[model samples]
Target: MRFRIKKVINNNILCVTDADGSEMIVTGRGLGFGHKVGEQVDSASVQKTYRMTNPTVQQKLLDLLEQIPYEHFLLTDELVGEIRKRISYPLNESLLITLADHINFAIKRQKQGLLYKNPLLEPIRECYPEEFKMGRYCIKRIKEKLSVSLPEDEAGFIALHIVNAELNTSMSVMNDITRFVDGCIKVIESYYGKKFDHTSLAFSRLAVHLRFFAQRLFQNGQDSGKEEYDKKFRSLIARNCKEHYQCAETVAAYAENVWHKKVSDEEILFMAIHLKRVNLSEQHSD
Candidate 1:
């Protein structure tokens, strides 16, 4: 797996190949040690450059460089320059590359019958009163695109694209965490159930809420204590969990199908962690 450097972006390197390749961002301190633009990276060194969860994605990055071993800086700017026109945040070069990587991998995944399965209702159904139709909405659009519903992570990826374009790019500027929460609520409630304990419901709801809370807080130029937000979000999740921690598994089932970057085991485990923290804190004094 040898690849040529297609672009040198400060500490973030990117390369392209003959077969559609992902624009991988090389990360690992000193991995860039003495590397220059257009230099062909040996196969062994390429493995040391980055650690990505997706093996196919890792190979794609390597392939891109292997295919195109030499590049001029002007070509790098040219690609970015073209993408910038359509992208909301080109200056956010790293995210731009991430999105490109996602798109390329998604296409390949599609070829391998690995489409995402948007788990909109399986988990929410147990709760019953949430009525989130996004699962259905996503299912409809996804089926139309692929002749079948996409998987959860794939749905998450597509939703990310929609969320990015509809609200704003620069997830930092994104303030729609509440909207995502509301969307989840609507999807759950839309299912055949209509009654849920507020406490049980809040756990999943708060989880959705906090997904973007940190970024929104920073974007708004506020001096927010993440611990403070974590406390609140946790309190809500715990009250819900104490009533029914069992539902956390269901919520995780949905998350597993919805989100891609993190596995469901991780998501469900974090829910417990958040709940435990809440039990200890009780409540922060004003």
Candidate 2:
């Protein structure tokens, strides 16, 4: 459908108003070249349409496009298209615009030698293996096309963004989820009076479990399972691994206090086992 160009940001991009009266940013080579306000854009010439509903993100994207070279958008289009094709999960459409803005800024920062490290990189890789792998792939493509070497930490950041989109949650919500997971880890550490190896496979599994656990808690308010066998399994764990089970209880207590919802017995059982394995691994390594 044809849209009226509201404003031209540059030769390659323009802000246009759709028939629904909402604004959308359209991008294509020479799409805005000689286009002016109140001008009709030939619908067939549109290469990419960013229908982002968040005004703040849209404005930031417009600002980013103004500052960065036009090629960033082209690269972002191909990268996002490939990511959509490769990832099995459904990602939010907003990611198309937001990721491009992030990568463009990241490239600019990398070039200026002002790189930032993602402190959660290890946790992210351990927790979201598939998303993190896709993040690395995004960086590889950037390196190949743009010739910029972004650090591995960038992959983690990108993965988080993907997670955000997948969850249909905002960055703030993701931050809260991360803090919730970290708080649970602290409770486990305090109970054992020692730190578990974050790099250990068992710890990674625990983190991954807690990641989805927190997500479910936020999304649906509680975990879903009513099997009597699950209760029996948890009881068995409590009897066999009393100490780790106790630690898991403390974590469960924290969850209840924060979310006002009791953690499922199945969750506590799985967590205790993971904590036990991780603790044993750490002691052996020591």
Candidate 3:
């Protein structure tokens, strides 16, 4: 199976077209050496081929690979492979581009003594435990391979990348989700007149719940329907957890006002319960 070279990125990477006219990014040492467009590439020598089926995503991958060090690119590829095996959900191919870009930047930052701390690291870890664990594994691998010691916050960032990939949402929507979760946190903190220790398990659990709640809102576009049982439970919360229920209402109101979307009563109920636990812990600590 021969491929026609379309463009040579470097001696180790090139873009080629298969017999079916499908474009692929081929990688192999010396594969693109002295290669010219329209030249025949021996498929046997190609070490790996990534389908350039999505033009936008593939172009982003090309752009990122072009800037990243070759060794780092290989490391990122291995990390992605490990993550794929460990996680249950199917990750999008776009993880290749985004995760590569992130890992490359992370290494560069660590080397330069300039690490951007993830403010939501605790929340991210709490919300996506499995992904966060995978992120830790990824960081460990990076340290072993690159000798770059990164902070735990980097693990949270990686987890967010994995979660973003699993959701198959665009980067923009992922950003919105992050912002929404932050807003919800602020609402909770403001109502209680205190900052929740972000590293606290309770805070992390709340963060995780809010992340999924935000995902549901963005995915379905609205709070559509509530089952009779759910309505009853929500009402029960309103009756019993009065203070917690009010805090939830404040959060729901803030989300609705800013995003112009309705928050389901069911969401308010769960959030109130979560908030109740957090507030109770704070009181106990005091």
On lDDT, the candidate that comes out on top is 3
Lowest lDDT sum, 10 consecutive residues, model 2, at 217-226
Candidate 2: regions farther than 4 A off: 18-22, 53-64, 170-176, 179-208, 216-286
Evaluate residue 119 in candidate 3 and report its C-alpha lDDT on the 0 to 100 scale.
79
lDDT of 1 by residue, 1-286 (tens): 6566655544434442312454454533344557777676554544224434566656654545333312222232233344345433324333323444454455556768876654533333322222223323443543564454445555344344434433345543442443334444444334314533444534444544444432333233233346666667756665665532434454544443553223233344454655444333433311
Question: How do these models rank on lDDT, best leading?
Answer: 3, 2, 1
Alpha-carbon RMSD to native, per candidate: 15.4, 5.4, 4.7
Kindly report the root-mean-square deviation of model 3 from the true structure over all alpha carbons. 4.7
lDDT of 2: 0.82
User: lDDT of each prediction vs. the true structure?
Assistant: 0.43, 0.82, 0.84
- TM-score, candidate number 3: 0.74
279, model 1: CA deviation in Å?
37
Candidate 3 residue 96 Cα shift, in angstroms, is 1.1
TM-score of each: 0.27, 0.69, 0.74
State how far residue 260 of model 1 sits from its true place (Å).
23
